[model samples]
Target: MTKRVFIIAAVSLYIISAYFSFYYFSTGSISGLTQKINLPLVKYKPPVDSKGNVIIDTSAPKTEECPLSGEMLTKAHKALWEKRRPLGVMIENSIDARPQSGLTSADIIYEAVAEGGITRFLAVFYCKDSDGYVGPVRSARVYFIDMLSEYGDFPLYAHVGGANCNRTTGSGCGNGAPADALGKIAKLKWVSYNDLNHIPYPVMWRDYDRLPNRATEHTVYSTTVKLWAYAGEKRKLSNVDDEGNEWNSQFDGWKFKDDESVNPSEAGKIDFIFWQGKSDYDVTWEYDSKGNSYKRLNGGTPHLNKNNDKQIEAKNVVIVFMAESTARDNYTEGSHLLYKTTGDGEAIIFQDGKAIKGRWRKKDVFTRIKFYDTRGSEVALNRGQVFIEILPKGNTVNY
Candidate 1:
């Protein structure tokens, strides 16, 4: 009986030892595997995809209709103003380019105001394109103008450069004092071959110089004009462009001196405003000239010659608001990462005070934000503050 009892005890001890050995080995293996898989502790909700790749979420609440007229803003208009802000506003007499139709004769209006004590103006011109995307090519010119005129007398500066559509090999035009008749009206300070580099996508001076066509669209010119009220007192100011060109108080007026085509009736048709230390104006033409049926006064001439006779023949003027930044500073271009934290609720993003569409995960430890353009390619954000708000699920109050 004693031998049988001892045998049973030995078997029990062996079984317990074997079980502990297996448990320790399995536990150690699992620990090593966990270390190798070191993933982010925060749960990230990846963006949804369509066929094979990820797509940008642009279905958010956008300003579709024109803020003033209640008409739907077209894709082109949105694309232009989405990343630009006006230092001043100008309205010229012209026709609508979208519908390609003429309107009843009206006076051209220009208005300027001060923002944060800095004078700026908004210029609006009617455009008509007969064979372009829109009907008669009616369009507007929206951009920033220097406010140095307020300090003294500075000539109006325009930036005609390459479009962001193609970044590889594009440039701006440099039509300054020496080339154009500006020497008599204003002094050409500098000519640069680059676009204005603000936030988001800072325009690099070196890149501007590297552009191929320096005299064409790859260059920008700046000139200064002096306005003497009475005595020989001289008031000096500076006008600068993206290329770092400086204009002082010695520039002559419009260079197209030989073009003796001035209509008295058209004089009152164009209006002007001085705001933000800048001069903003618009000109409207009543009839097409004999030489050029399509050209009008105050219009952007394709070439430097006076033969084109491009005129500003617009009617209804709509002032579109320009954003404060460029494409590089406003959107996340190239490769970038955005992070956001959310409670057990919902989150929303707004650009220029409008909501962007997409689903956001709740209670996620950390979330990543990515941006892309209409073509599903990555984009860069320009300079300016974007509004971001986080709210609880089903709760109107933002967190």
Candidate 2:
């Protein structure tokens, strides 16, 4: 009887494996399988107000424009954001960290290669609130720090760890290392003020259940509500800092406009890779006419947000080509990298199902990067989520 039962169990397992194998081979991808398996178990609940009301109400009229992305929002939404400073979270982009949460809620997302060919995101949140978790949180890099500087004075920066100096020798990535993010944070007086490095539990926690079998490195998760609450309650930071100054008093935000009606195009896709032959990190943005937005795909699969199982979409996709170089800090594992973040560079802005060949300029690290069209006029991006891709200067962007 025991032998007969074992044989039956083995046959059952084999049949299940064979079925999935056949599906994978036919589709050339397992994303369909992932969706089928994961969607059923989803019990996600969006955040709620004190009265148990859902914070995001799509039916409400959106009149207040977001200072970060110029996306209009309801008065209720603006009230919540008005009490908090801009929050920038470091989210990893490894294959294991797929279907990242809360990306669809970010006002602006900045993507760049963190190490080797693997990319990372600096998701900026201010005007909008995420309905669910925000990360598989990751370490920081110095360039992301510079990009976040444009948000406001001492915006909330959340990360696990960052490129820092050797604690004992104090030599590896100290004051002068280009990739010494912690060093820069300290120099800017943000060590304990607004920089959240490996925040305590409840604010940021590890969830092995979100994606089973994920390595420990990809389990750290946080939410905008928690981070903002921590910032306000623990760190004494909000829309106004401890010094009684507003966060966006000096912020030079980009211009925004409503979507433009355009003729349908036969081809409306943008594809590129951060590093050569790193196909898993390749990115594609497909323009959708009805939505007037560009849907994102990573590694040839729809990049869905785990919170709502919705594909990532953006109103504007800006590609900035900059010179990339290794920091040569000589850490034992591998040298860090640096990008030309503060300067003029060739850029391509995609909106209205079309491309605008342009240039980007940032006078300094604290200055907002602005895009200019071929005619030398500042381009007004569509009013919604803006995704900025920082690619190597020589990389080709196929559209």
Candidate 3:
């Protein structure tokens, strides 16, 4: 019996030991199992160079090496390199101007070059006010012209302030007065200010190089200067000539003629008209006022409006229209009309301190609409000029 018991215990111990060994081997807890089974172990081999130095793999698979060190050029590194290239060009190679100011001649020249790509520019500065101090103020315009002339042979004209003297008029006193041969040169080619906003490449040349016949002639005179453009049914103030003549005319029925030859050069000359008298004269002209008269000096305001807080609202649709002249009247399509609207509400048009509506239409020229909620109901306000917004009714909101 003792011999049989000993034999049974020994067999049981052997079975338990085998089971534990199999579990550990299957779970990989027992290392070198594959070796013990005569299987090969996986090994990593890095690529080598001719000198036996490890060649870091920078290829798409990302073998090795730092991207900054150029061992491997990652997508992120390439992108960063491209982004910095333009900035380098600008920093290392840029034209420099003299006597820099918030609104400096250098700034004007640089801006023209940057925008138009024109290497040359003729900045014509003129005085719009005629009273107050004189002396240096009168000569400042001439001085600027002389300074600009030193750089290149650009057509420069100066304006002399008269009762009607203003920037738009391009009229000046003495040799620079309007109707004078010089004024005509200053008013040469009616280039729209908008077109000139961005300087074109080969900046020295105009779109067509349609140089004014009068610009070639160096003459000076004075006369009643007016911008011959037409304003459709919509009436709004614009910049004035040296004589304080604003370009606010009403065209009941005007259209552009098919004849393209009528002052085709005028298109490039009248870049665009800007309003100058909407704000205080001192702020716009940057000149000091003496009693009832004003004189220009080193400073003047370029913008016409000053009250930034003021806003224009539309009670109804408001339309604005413009044309080169009454004889050449035509409606410009795709012209934008700004307004605010709600899901359900009355529209109001606001401009120049007045809330107006039903005053503009397609037949009348340019039209804009302003939505209002007269029912005292809630309305959503989406504010934007070009992009239209349609919102569900809620509470009264300001756009």
User: Clashes in each model (backbone N, CA, C under 3 Å)?
Assistant: 81, 0, 74
Q: Tens digit of lDDT per residue, candidate 3, span 1-399? A: 999999999999999878769866666555544434445785445465797533433353532222111122333323222211000000000122111111111111111111112111222211111111111101112112222222211222222221222355433232233212222224433123201111222221121122123231111211111111110111111233333343222212111111111222211111111122311211111111111111111113232111121111111111222111111111122111111211223333322222222222221112112223344332222111111111112312121
lDDT of 2 at 2: 100
Tens-digit per-residue lDDT, 200-292, candidate 1: 111111123322333322222111101111001211222343333443223221111112343323322222221222222121222233321
**Tens-place lDDT digits, model 2, residues 117-236:** 899999999987787899999999999999999987999999999987786765545436778888899998999889998998999999999988999999999999889989999888
Q: Is candidate 1 or candidate 3 better by lDDT?
A: 1
lDDT against the true structure, per candidate, is: 0.24, 0.90, 0.22
Alpha carbon lDDT of residue 368, candidate 3?
17
TM-score of 2: 0.85
> Best to worst by lDDT, what's the order?
2, 1, 3
The model with the greatest lDDT is 2
Global Cα RMSD, each model: 24.9, 20.4, 27.4
The reply for model 2, stretches above 4 Å from the true place, is: 1-54, 167-171
If both were scored by lDDT, which would come out higher, candidate 2 or candidate 3? 2
* Number of backbone clashes in candidate 3: 74
